[model samples]
Target: MDMQSGTVEEALDKAAAVGVTAVVQVGCDLERSRWAAEVAGRHENVHATVALHPNEAPRIRREEGPGALDAALDEIAALAALPQVRGVGETGLDYFRTGADGIEAQTYSFRRHLRIAKEVGKALVIHDRDAHQDVLRVLREEGAPGTVVFHCFSGDAAMAEECAAAGYYMSFAGNVTFKSAQPLRDALAVAPLDLLLVETDAPFLTPAPYRGRPNAPYLIPVTLRAMAAVKGVDEDELATAVAANTARAFGCPPPR
Candidate 1:
Protein backbone atom coordinates (compact mmCIF):
# COMPACT_ATOMS: atom_id res chain seq x y z
CA MET A 1 0.00 0.00 0.00
CA ASP A 2 1.18 3.54 -0.70
CA MET A 3 2.16 4.83 2.73
CA GLN A 4 0.56 8.21 2.21
CA SER A 5 -2.80 6.69 1.31
CA GLY A 6 -2.65 4.02 4.00
CA THR A 7 -1.00 5.67 6.97
CA VAL A 8 1.95 3.97 8.74
CA GLU A 9 -0.04 3.75 11.99
CA GLU A 10 -2.91 2.03 10.20
CA ALA A 11 -0.71 -0.45 8.40
CA LEU A 12 1.40 -1.08 11.47
CA ASP A 13 -1.70 -1.65 13.55
CA LYS A 14 -2.90 -4.12 10.93
CA ALA A 15 0.47 -5.86 10.64
CA ALA A 16 0.92 -6.29 14.39
CA ALA A 17 -2.57 -7.70 14.61
CA VAL A 18 -1.96 -10.03 11.66
CA GLY A 19 1.50 -11.11 12.90
CA VAL A 20 3.17 -10.08 9.65
CA THR A 21 6.41 -8.17 9.83
CA ALA A 22 7.60 -5.64 7.24
CA VAL A 23 5.33 -3.50 5.12
CA VAL A 24 6.52 -1.88 1.87
CA GLN A 25 4.84 1.51 1.80
CA VAL A 26 4.50 2.79 -1.76
CA GLY A 27 4.75 6.47 -2.83
CA CYS A 28 3.26 8.02 -5.97
CA ASP A 29 3.97 11.75 -5.82
CA LEU A 30 6.45 14.22 -4.35
CA GLU A 31 4.61 14.84 -1.09
CA ARG A 32 3.48 11.24 -0.66
CA SER A 33 6.95 10.00 -1.49
CA ARG A 34 8.28 12.11 1.31
CA TRP A 35 5.58 10.80 3.62
CA ALA A 36 6.43 7.22 2.74
CA ALA A 37 10.06 7.84 3.62
CA GLU A 38 8.99 9.34 6.90
CA VAL A 39 6.89 6.26 7.65
CA ALA A 40 9.77 3.97 6.76
CA GLY A 41 12.01 5.92 9.12
CA ARG A 42 9.75 5.14 12.06
CA HIS A 43 9.23 1.41 11.37
CA GLU A 44 12.32 -0.70 10.86
CA ASN A 45 10.18 -3.23 9.04
CA VAL A 46 8.82 -0.74 6.55
CA HIS A 47 10.39 0.16 3.15
CA ALA A 48 9.29 2.66 0.49
CA THR A 49 9.14 3.09 -3.28
CA VAL A 50 9.05 6.56 -4.85
CA ALA A 51 7.02 6.90 -8.01
CA LEU A 52 4.77 9.17 -10.10
CA HIS A 53 2.06 7.14 -11.72
CA PRO A 54 1.58 7.55 -15.48
CA ASN A 55 -1.97 8.75 -14.95
CA GLU A 56 -0.82 11.27 -12.42
CA ALA A 57 1.86 12.33 -14.87
CA PRO A 58 -0.88 13.97 -16.91
CA ARG A 59 -1.95 15.96 -13.88
CA ILE A 60 1.49 17.49 -13.77
CA ARG A 61 0.35 19.21 -16.93
CA ARG A 62 -3.18 20.48 -17.50
CA GLU A 63 -3.05 18.88 -20.92
CA GLU A 64 -4.16 15.27 -20.78
CA GLY A 65 -1.97 13.93 -23.56
CA PRO A 66 1.46 12.62 -24.35
CA GLY A 67 4.49 14.88 -23.43
CA ALA A 68 3.95 14.73 -19.68
CA LEU A 69 6.83 12.27 -19.64
CA ASP A 70 9.58 14.82 -19.15
CA ALA A 71 7.97 16.47 -16.14
CA ALA A 72 7.18 13.08 -14.64
CA LEU A 73 10.75 11.90 -15.17
CA ASP A 74 12.08 14.88 -13.27
CA GLU A 75 9.58 14.31 -10.46
CA ILE A 76 10.53 10.67 -10.09
CA ALA A 77 14.24 11.55 -10.10
CA ALA A 78 13.78 13.98 -7.24
CA LEU A 79 11.79 11.42 -5.25
CA ALA A 80 14.54 8.83 -5.87
CA ALA A 81 16.91 10.98 -3.85
CA LEU A 82 15.09 10.25 -0.60
CA PRO A 83 17.06 7.84 1.60
CA GLN A 84 14.10 5.91 2.93
CA VAL A 85 12.65 5.36 -0.51
CA ARG A 86 14.26 2.15 -1.78
CA GLY A 87 12.70 1.56 -5.22
CA VAL A 88 11.39 3.53 -8.23
CA GLY A 89 7.94 3.05 -9.54
CA GLU A 90 4.39 1.71 -9.61
CA THR A 91 4.99 3.44 -12.94
CA GLY A 92 4.12 1.69 -16.20
CA LEU A 93 1.47 1.47 -18.95
CA ASP A 94 -2.28 1.20 -18.58
CA TYR A 95 -4.49 1.00 -21.70
CA PHE A 96 -7.57 -0.55 -20.18
CA ARG A 97 -10.20 1.79 -21.62
CA THR A 98 -10.77 4.18 -24.47
CA GLY A 99 -10.00 7.93 -24.40
CA ALA A 100 -7.02 7.28 -22.13
CA ASP A 101 -3.53 8.61 -22.58
CA GLY A 102 -1.69 7.24 -25.57
CA ILE A 103 0.88 4.44 -25.42
CA GLU A 104 3.64 6.78 -26.58
CA ALA A 105 3.38 8.76 -23.35
CA GLN A 106 3.19 5.57 -21.35
CA THR A 107 6.27 4.18 -23.11
CA TYR A 108 8.15 7.39 -22.58
CA SER A 109 7.18 7.40 -18.90
CA PHE A 110 8.14 3.74 -18.44
CA ARG A 111 11.56 4.28 -19.98
CA ARG A 112 12.23 7.20 -17.65
CA HIS A 113 11.40 5.08 -14.61
CA LEU A 114 13.74 2.37 -15.90
CA ARG A 115 16.51 4.89 -16.34
CA ILE A 116 16.12 6.21 -12.80
CA ALA A 117 15.88 2.73 -11.30
CA LYS A 118 19.02 1.68 -13.15
CA GLU A 119 20.91 4.77 -12.07
CA VAL A 120 19.94 4.42 -8.41
CA GLY A 121 20.33 0.62 -8.33
CA LYS A 122 16.82 0.51 -6.94
CA ALA A 123 14.24 -2.09 -7.84
CA LEU A 124 11.65 -1.17 -10.49
CA VAL A 125 8.05 -1.64 -9.35
CA ILE A 126 6.41 -1.90 -12.76
CA HIS A 127 2.66 -1.53 -13.13
CA ASP A 128 1.57 -3.18 -16.38
CA ARG A 129 -2.10 -2.81 -17.16
CA ASP A 130 -3.21 -4.25 -20.50
CA ALA A 131 0.01 -3.20 -22.20
CA HIS A 132 2.44 -6.06 -21.64
CA GLN A 133 4.46 -6.00 -24.85
CA ASP A 134 5.21 -2.30 -24.57
CA VAL A 135 6.26 -2.67 -20.94
CA LEU A 136 8.55 -5.56 -21.91
CA ARG A 137 9.96 -3.55 -24.80
CA VAL A 138 10.94 -0.55 -22.68
CA LEU A 139 12.65 -2.68 -20.05
CA ARG A 140 14.46 -4.73 -22.65
CA GLU A 141 15.50 -1.64 -24.56
CA GLU A 142 16.77 0.21 -21.50
CA GLY A 143 18.72 -2.76 -20.11
CA ALA A 144 17.43 -2.25 -16.58
CA PRO A 145 20.01 -3.29 -13.95
CA GLY A 146 18.34 -3.23 -10.55
CA THR A 147 15.71 -5.82 -9.70
CA VAL A 148 12.56 -5.51 -11.81
CA VAL A 149 9.26 -6.36 -10.14
CA PHE A 150 6.03 -6.80 -12.11
CA HIS A 151 3.75 -5.38 -9.48
CA CYS A 152 0.36 -7.04 -9.35
CA PHE A 153 1.38 -9.17 -12.32
CA SER A 154 -1.62 -10.29 -14.36
CA GLY A 155 0.07 -12.06 -17.23
CA ASP A 156 -0.13 -15.82 -17.84
CA ALA A 157 2.55 -18.56 -18.05
CA ALA A 158 4.17 -17.58 -21.32
CA MET A 159 4.34 -13.98 -20.24
CA ALA A 160 5.75 -15.11 -16.94
CA GLU A 161 8.47 -16.94 -18.86
CA GLU A 162 9.33 -13.75 -20.69
CA CYS A 163 9.62 -11.90 -17.40
CA ALA A 164 11.63 -14.73 -15.81
CA ALA A 165 13.96 -14.85 -18.79
CA ALA A 166 14.66 -11.18 -18.27
CA GLY A 167 15.60 -11.83 -14.62
CA TYR A 168 12.50 -9.98 -13.46
CA TYR A 169 10.07 -10.93 -10.71
CA MET A 170 6.35 -11.70 -10.89
CA SER A 171 4.37 -10.39 -7.91
CA PHE A 172 0.95 -11.91 -7.45
CA ALA A 173 -1.79 -10.03 -5.67
CA GLY A 174 -5.22 -10.91 -4.25
CA ASN A 175 -6.52 -11.52 -7.76
CA VAL A 176 -4.63 -14.79 -7.72
CA THR A 177 -7.18 -16.19 -5.30
CA PHE A 178 -10.13 -15.71 -7.59
CA LYS A 179 -11.68 -18.87 -8.99
CA SER A 180 -11.05 -17.46 -12.48
CA ALA A 181 -7.35 -17.14 -11.74
CA GLN A 182 -6.29 -20.40 -13.38
CA PRO A 183 -4.00 -18.58 -15.76
CA LEU A 184 -2.47 -16.70 -12.87
CA ARG A 185 -2.04 -19.96 -11.00
CA ASP A 186 -0.30 -21.53 -13.98
CA ALA A 187 1.97 -18.55 -14.22
CA LEU A 188 2.79 -18.80 -10.53
CA ALA A 189 3.57 -22.51 -10.82
CA VAL A 190 6.35 -21.98 -13.33
CA ALA A 191 7.80 -18.71 -12.00
CA PRO A 192 11.05 -19.56 -10.23
CA LEU A 193 10.45 -19.81 -6.50
CA ASP A 194 12.97 -17.13 -5.71
CA LEU A 195 11.38 -14.78 -8.22
CA LEU A 196 7.86 -15.14 -6.91
CA LEU A 197 6.57 -12.26 -4.75
CA VAL A 198 3.15 -11.65 -3.27
CA GLU A 199 1.25 -8.46 -2.42
CA THR A 200 -2.29 -7.39 -1.65
CA ASP A 201 -2.08 -4.22 -3.86
CA ALA A 202 -4.35 -2.97 -1.14
CA PRO A 203 -7.38 -0.78 -1.86
CA PHE A 204 -7.71 -2.81 -5.07
CA LEU A 205 -7.76 -6.43 -6.29
CA THR A 206 -8.78 -7.88 -2.96
CA PRO A 207 -8.35 -11.69 -2.98
CA ALA A 208 -11.40 -14.02 -2.89
CA PRO A 209 -13.42 -14.41 0.31
CA TYR A 210 -12.35 -10.85 1.02
CA ARG A 211 -13.38 -9.45 -2.34
CA GLY A 212 -15.43 -6.24 -2.52
CA ARG A 213 -13.88 -5.07 0.73
CA PRO A 214 -11.28 -2.41 1.31
CA ASN A 215 -8.08 -4.40 0.70
CA ALA A 216 -5.16 -4.32 3.13
CA PRO A 217 -1.68 -5.77 3.70
CA TYR A 218 -2.91 -8.37 6.17
CA LEU A 219 -4.91 -10.08 3.43
CA ILE A 220 -1.65 -11.23 1.85
CA PRO A 221 -2.35 -14.67 3.21
CA VAL A 222 -5.12 -15.13 0.68
CA THR A 223 -2.53 -14.86 -2.06
CA LEU A 224 -0.29 -17.42 -0.35
CA ARG A 225 -3.07 -19.97 -0.23
CA ALA A 226 -3.74 -19.79 -3.94
CA MET A 227 -0.06 -19.81 -4.84
CA ALA A 228 0.69 -22.75 -2.57
CA ALA A 229 -2.10 -24.75 -4.13
CA VAL A 230 -0.93 -23.92 -7.63
CA LYS A 231 2.70 -24.80 -6.92
CA GLY A 232 1.65 -27.90 -5.01
CA VAL A 233 3.58 -26.63 -1.99
CA ASP A 234 2.56 -26.17 1.60
CA GLU A 235 1.23 -22.80 2.70
CA ASP A 236 4.20 -22.23 5.00
CA GLU A 237 6.70 -22.94 2.24
CA LEU A 238 4.92 -20.60 -0.12
CA ALA A 239 4.81 -17.90 2.50
CA THR A 240 8.51 -18.26 3.13
CA ALA A 241 9.26 -18.06 -0.58
CA VAL A 242 7.16 -14.91 -1.02
CA ALA A 243 8.79 -13.24 1.95
CA ALA A 244 12.27 -14.06 0.69
CA ASN A 245 11.49 -12.96 -2.85
CA THR A 246 10.05 -9.63 -1.71
CA ALA A 247 12.98 -8.97 0.62
CA ARG A 248 15.53 -9.93 -2.00
CA ALA A 249 13.99 -7.71 -4.64
CA PHE A 250 13.39 -4.63 -2.50
CA GLY A 251 16.55 -4.97 -0.36
CA CYS A 252 14.28 -5.16 2.66
CA PRO A 253 15.71 -7.59 5.19
CA PRO A 254 13.84 -10.83 5.84
CA PRO A 255 11.70 -11.10 8.97
CA ARG A 256 13.59 -12.15 12.07
Candidate 2:
Protein backbone atom coordinates (compact mmCIF):
# COMPACT_ATOMS: atom_id res chain seq x y z
CA MET A 1 0.00 0.00 0.00
CA ASP A 2 2.96 2.33 0.44
CA MET A 3 3.24 2.45 -3.33
CA GLN A 4 -0.40 3.44 -3.68
CA SER A 5 -2.20 6.68 -2.84
CA GLY A 6 -4.29 5.49 0.13
CA THR A 7 -3.33 5.04 3.77
CA VAL A 8 -2.25 1.63 5.08
CA GLU A 9 -5.36 1.48 7.24
CA GLU A 10 -7.56 1.97 4.22
CA ALA A 11 -5.69 -0.75 2.34
CA LEU A 12 -6.16 -3.13 5.26
CA ASP A 13 -9.86 -2.34 5.41
CA LYS A 14 -10.33 -3.02 1.70
CA ALA A 15 -8.29 -6.20 1.88
CA ALA A 16 -10.35 -7.60 4.75
CA ALA A 17 -13.62 -6.76 3.06
CA VAL A 18 -12.44 -8.62 -0.06
CA GLY A 19 -11.44 -11.80 1.86
CA VAL A 20 -7.72 -11.18 2.16
CA THR A 21 -7.02 -12.63 5.60
CA ALA A 22 -3.45 -11.38 5.84
CA VAL A 23 -0.87 -9.41 3.91
CA VAL A 24 2.91 -9.37 4.10
CA GLN A 25 4.33 -5.95 3.26
CA VAL A 26 8.03 -6.09 2.34
CA GLY A 27 10.65 -3.32 2.70
CA CYS A 28 13.38 -2.64 0.11
CA ASP A 29 15.46 -0.33 2.32
CA LEU A 30 16.04 0.67 5.95
CA GLU A 31 13.55 3.55 5.99
CA ARG A 32 10.84 1.60 4.15
CA SER A 33 11.53 -1.41 6.36
CA ARG A 34 10.88 0.69 9.44
CA TRP A 35 7.70 2.02 7.85
CA ALA A 36 6.58 -1.55 7.08
CA ALA A 37 7.27 -2.63 10.66
CA GLU A 38 5.26 0.29 11.96
CA VAL A 39 2.38 -0.60 9.67
CA ALA A 40 2.54 -4.23 10.75
CA GLY A 41 2.50 -3.15 14.38
CA ARG A 42 -0.69 -1.20 13.80
CA HIS A 43 -2.56 -4.00 11.97
CA GLU A 44 -3.13 -7.52 13.20
CA ASN A 45 -3.68 -8.83 9.69
CA VAL A 46 -0.39 -7.43 8.37
CA HIS A 47 3.20 -8.66 8.65
CA ALA A 48 6.52 -7.35 7.28
CA THR A 49 9.84 -8.40 5.78
CA VAL A 50 12.89 -6.12 5.98
CA ALA A 51 15.83 -6.11 3.58
CA LEU A 52 18.05 -4.09 1.26
CA HIS A 53 17.08 -4.92 -2.31
CA PRO A 54 19.82 -5.96 -4.77
CA ASN A 55 19.46 -2.76 -6.82
CA GLU A 56 19.65 -0.65 -3.68
CA ALA A 57 22.90 -2.31 -2.61
CA PRO A 58 25.14 -0.75 -5.28
CA ARG A 59 23.59 2.69 -4.91
CA ILE A 60 24.22 2.66 -1.15
CA ARG A 61 27.79 1.47 -1.66
CA ARG A 62 28.49 4.24 -4.17
CA GLU A 63 26.61 7.08 -2.44
CA GLU A 64 27.40 6.34 1.22
CA GLY A 65 30.91 4.89 0.84
CA PRO A 66 32.17 1.31 1.17
CA GLY A 67 31.32 0.44 4.81
CA ALA A 68 27.86 1.99 4.62
CA LEU A 69 26.37 -1.15 3.07
CA ASP A 70 27.56 -3.13 6.08
CA ALA A 71 25.93 -0.60 8.41
CA ALA A 72 22.65 -0.90 6.51
CA LEU A 73 22.86 -4.70 6.71
CA ASP A 74 23.34 -4.42 10.46
CA GLU A 75 20.21 -2.30 10.70
CA ILE A 76 18.31 -4.86 8.60
CA ALA A 77 19.48 -7.61 10.93
CA ALA A 78 18.16 -5.65 13.90
CA LEU A 79 14.82 -5.08 12.19
CA ALA A 80 14.48 -8.80 11.35
CA ALA A 81 14.31 -9.50 15.10
CA LEU A 82 11.14 -7.43 15.48
CA PRO A 83 7.97 -9.37 16.32
CA GLN A 84 6.11 -7.73 13.44
CA VAL A 85 8.83 -8.79 11.00
CA ARG A 86 8.08 -12.30 9.74
CA GLY A 87 10.77 -12.55 7.03
CA VAL A 88 14.07 -11.11 5.78
CA GLY A 89 13.88 -10.23 2.18
CA GLU A 90 12.87 -9.18 -1.17
CA THR A 91 16.60 -9.81 -1.10
CA GLY A 92 18.66 -12.13 -3.34
CA LEU A 93 20.15 -11.65 -6.84
CA ASP A 94 18.79 -9.26 -9.48
CA TYR A 95 21.36 -9.16 -12.27
CA PHE A 96 18.80 -7.70 -14.65
CA ARG A 97 18.73 -4.38 -12.82
CA THR A 98 21.96 -4.31 -10.81
CA GLY A 99 24.45 -4.87 -13.70
CA ALA A 100 27.98 -6.37 -13.55
CA ASP A 101 29.49 -3.54 -11.51
CA GLY A 102 26.91 -4.05 -8.75
CA ILE A 103 26.96 -7.87 -8.71
CA GLU A 104 29.59 -8.09 -5.98
CA ALA A 105 27.72 -5.80 -3.60
CA GLN A 106 24.42 -7.52 -4.39
CA THR A 107 25.96 -10.91 -3.65
CA TYR A 108 27.40 -9.67 -0.36
CA SER A 109 24.12 -8.09 0.67
CA PHE A 110 22.22 -11.27 -0.25
CA ARG A 111 24.51 -13.40 1.88
CA ARG A 112 24.10 -11.10 4.88
CA HIS A 113 20.30 -11.16 4.53
CA LEU A 114 20.35 -14.95 4.39
CA ARG A 115 22.39 -15.13 7.59
CA ILE A 116 20.09 -12.66 9.31
CA ALA A 117 17.03 -14.74 8.34
CA LYS A 118 18.59 -17.87 9.81
CA GLU A 119 19.75 -16.04 12.92
CA VAL A 120 16.35 -14.53 13.58
CA GLY A 121 14.57 -17.81 12.73
CA LYS A 122 12.37 -16.00 10.23
CA ALA A 123 11.49 -16.85 6.64
CA LEU A 124 13.83 -15.72 3.84
CA VAL A 125 12.01 -14.04 0.96
CA ILE A 126 14.07 -13.95 -2.22
CA HIS A 127 13.78 -11.86 -5.36
CA ASP A 128 15.68 -13.73 -8.07
CA ARG A 129 15.75 -11.98 -11.44
CA ASP A 130 18.05 -13.22 -14.23
CA ALA A 131 20.45 -14.52 -11.60
CA HIS A 132 18.83 -17.79 -10.58
CA GLN A 133 22.00 -19.87 -10.66
CA ASP A 134 23.89 -17.46 -8.41
CA VAL A 135 20.97 -17.20 -6.03
CA LEU A 136 20.75 -20.99 -5.78
CA ARG A 137 24.51 -21.19 -5.36
CA VAL A 138 24.48 -18.79 -2.42
CA LEU A 139 21.54 -20.53 -0.79
CA ARG A 140 23.31 -23.87 -1.18
CA GLU A 141 26.58 -22.49 0.15
CA GLU A 142 25.14 -20.62 3.16
CA GLY A 143 22.31 -23.10 3.76
CA ALA A 144 18.90 -21.53 3.59
CA PRO A 145 16.71 -20.65 6.55
CA GLY A 146 13.97 -23.03 7.75
CA THR A 147 11.52 -21.27 5.45
CA VAL A 148 12.43 -19.80 2.05
CA VAL A 149 10.05 -18.10 -0.34
CA PHE A 150 10.90 -16.93 -3.88
CA HIS A 151 8.60 -13.95 -4.05
CA CYS A 152 7.33 -13.11 -7.55
CA PHE A 153 8.87 -16.34 -8.76
CA SER A 154 10.15 -15.90 -12.34
CA GLY A 155 11.37 -19.27 -13.44
CA ASP A 156 10.46 -22.25 -15.61
CA ALA A 157 9.10 -25.70 -14.69
CA ALA A 158 12.58 -27.11 -14.19
CA MET A 159 13.52 -24.29 -11.88
CA ALA A 160 10.22 -24.66 -10.06
CA GLU A 161 10.99 -28.33 -9.54
CA GLU A 162 14.44 -27.44 -8.24
CA CYS A 163 12.97 -25.00 -5.70
CA ALA A 164 10.31 -27.52 -4.74
CA ALA A 165 13.00 -30.13 -4.20
CA ALA A 166 14.82 -27.70 -1.91
CA GLY A 167 11.55 -27.17 -0.01
CA TYR A 168 11.18 -23.53 -1.08
CA TYR A 169 7.88 -21.75 -1.59
CA MET A 170 7.22 -20.16 -5.02
CA SER A 171 4.99 -17.09 -4.85
CA PHE A 172 3.23 -16.16 -8.09
CA ALA A 173 2.36 -12.52 -8.60
CA GLY A 174 -0.05 -10.69 -10.96
CA ASN A 175 2.37 -11.24 -13.84
CA VAL A 176 1.32 -14.88 -13.83
CA THR A 177 -1.97 -13.81 -15.37
CA PHE A 178 -0.42 -12.24 -18.45
CA LYS A 179 -0.89 -14.01 -21.81
CA SER A 180 2.84 -13.79 -22.48
CA ALA A 181 3.53 -15.65 -19.22
CA GLN A 182 2.77 -19.16 -20.46
CA PRO A 183 6.15 -20.34 -19.23
CA LEU A 184 5.34 -19.03 -15.77
CA ARG A 185 1.97 -20.76 -15.96
CA ASP A 186 3.71 -23.99 -16.88
CA ALA A 187 5.87 -23.64 -13.82
CA LEU A 188 2.78 -23.05 -11.73
CA ALA A 189 1.29 -26.28 -13.03
CA VAL A 190 4.39 -28.24 -12.04
CA ALA A 191 4.60 -26.63 -8.59
CA PRO A 192 3.06 -28.73 -5.86
CA LEU A 193 -0.23 -27.42 -4.54
CA ASP A 194 1.12 -27.51 -0.99
CA LEU A 195 3.99 -25.24 -2.00
CA LEU A 196 2.01 -22.66 -3.98
CA LEU A 197 1.42 -18.99 -3.05
CA VAL A 198 -0.09 -15.87 -4.68
CA GLU A 199 0.81 -12.20 -4.32
CA THR A 200 -0.19 -8.89 -5.85
CA ASP A 201 3.35 -7.34 -5.87
CA ALA A 202 1.38 -4.14 -5.87
CA PRO A 203 1.17 -1.36 -6.75
CA PHE A 204 2.88 -3.15 -9.69
CA LEU A 205 2.29 -6.19 -11.92
CA THR A 206 -1.45 -5.62 -11.80
CA PRO A 207 -3.45 -8.58 -13.26
CA ALA A 208 -5.13 -8.30 -16.66
CA PRO A 209 -8.32 -6.26 -17.29
CA TYR A 210 -6.78 -3.96 -14.70
CA ARG A 211 -3.19 -4.48 -15.88
CA GLY A 212 -2.23 -0.83 -16.27
CA ARG A 213 -3.92 0.43 -13.09
CA PRO A 214 -2.56 0.54 -9.58
CA ASN A 215 -2.78 -2.77 -7.69
CA ALA A 216 -3.65 -3.44 -4.04
CA PRO A 217 -4.23 -6.45 -1.80
CA TYR A 218 -7.90 -6.60 -2.71
CA LEU A 219 -6.91 -7.50 -6.28
CA ILE A 220 -5.20 -10.70 -5.15
CA PRO A 221 -8.27 -12.73 -6.01
CA VAL A 222 -7.68 -11.80 -9.64
CA THR A 223 -4.24 -13.39 -9.59
CA LEU A 224 -5.39 -16.33 -7.45
CA ARG A 225 -8.19 -17.13 -9.86
CA ALA A 226 -5.79 -17.05 -12.75
CA MET A 227 -3.43 -19.38 -10.92
CA ALA A 228 -6.22 -21.78 -10.09
CA ALA A 229 -7.25 -21.91 -13.71
CA VAL A 230 -3.71 -22.65 -14.80
CA LYS A 231 -3.41 -25.39 -12.21
CA GLY A 232 -6.79 -26.82 -13.23
CA VAL A 233 -8.23 -26.58 -9.72
CA ASP A 234 -11.25 -24.98 -8.18
CA GLU A 235 -10.71 -21.39 -7.01
CA ASP A 236 -11.72 -22.12 -3.41
CA GLU A 237 -9.41 -25.13 -3.22
CA LEU A 238 -6.51 -23.09 -4.51
CA ALA A 239 -7.38 -20.32 -2.06
CA THR A 240 -7.30 -22.74 0.86
CA ALA A 241 -3.99 -24.19 -0.30
CA VAL A 242 -2.47 -20.73 -0.75
CA ALA A 243 -3.60 -19.69 2.73
CA ALA A 244 -2.03 -22.76 4.30
CA ASN A 245 1.14 -22.39 2.23
CA THR A 246 1.47 -18.69 3.04
CA ALA A 247 1.15 -19.32 6.76
CA ARG A 248 3.75 -22.06 6.55
CA ALA A 249 6.08 -19.92 4.43
CA PHE A 250 5.98 -17.05 6.93
CA GLY A 251 6.17 -19.38 9.97
CA CYS A 252 2.93 -17.93 11.27
CA PRO A 253 -0.54 -19.23 12.03
CA PRO A 254 -3.30 -18.18 9.70
CA PRO A 255 -5.15 -15.10 10.93
CA ARG A 256 -8.53 -15.89 12.48
Candidate that would win on TM-score: 2
Let me know the TM-score candidate 1 reaches against the reference structure: 0.90
- How far does residue 97 in candidate 1 sit from its true spot (Å)? 4.1
Residue 53, candidate 1: Cα error in Å is 1.3
RMSD to the true structure for each prediction, in A, is 2.3, 0.9
For model 1, residues 120-234, the per-residue Cα lDDT tens digits are 8899998888888878877777887669998889898999998998889988889888888888888988998889988878788888888888788888777678788888989
- Candidate 2 lDDT over 80-129, as tens digits, reads 99999999998999988777999999998999999999999999999999
TM of each candidate vs. truth: 0.90, 0.98
Clashing pairs in 1: none
Model 2 whole-model lDDT (C-alpha atoms) = 0.91
User: Considering summed lDDT, which 10 consecutive residues are worst modelled in model 1?
Assistant: 97-106
Off by over 4 Å in 2: none
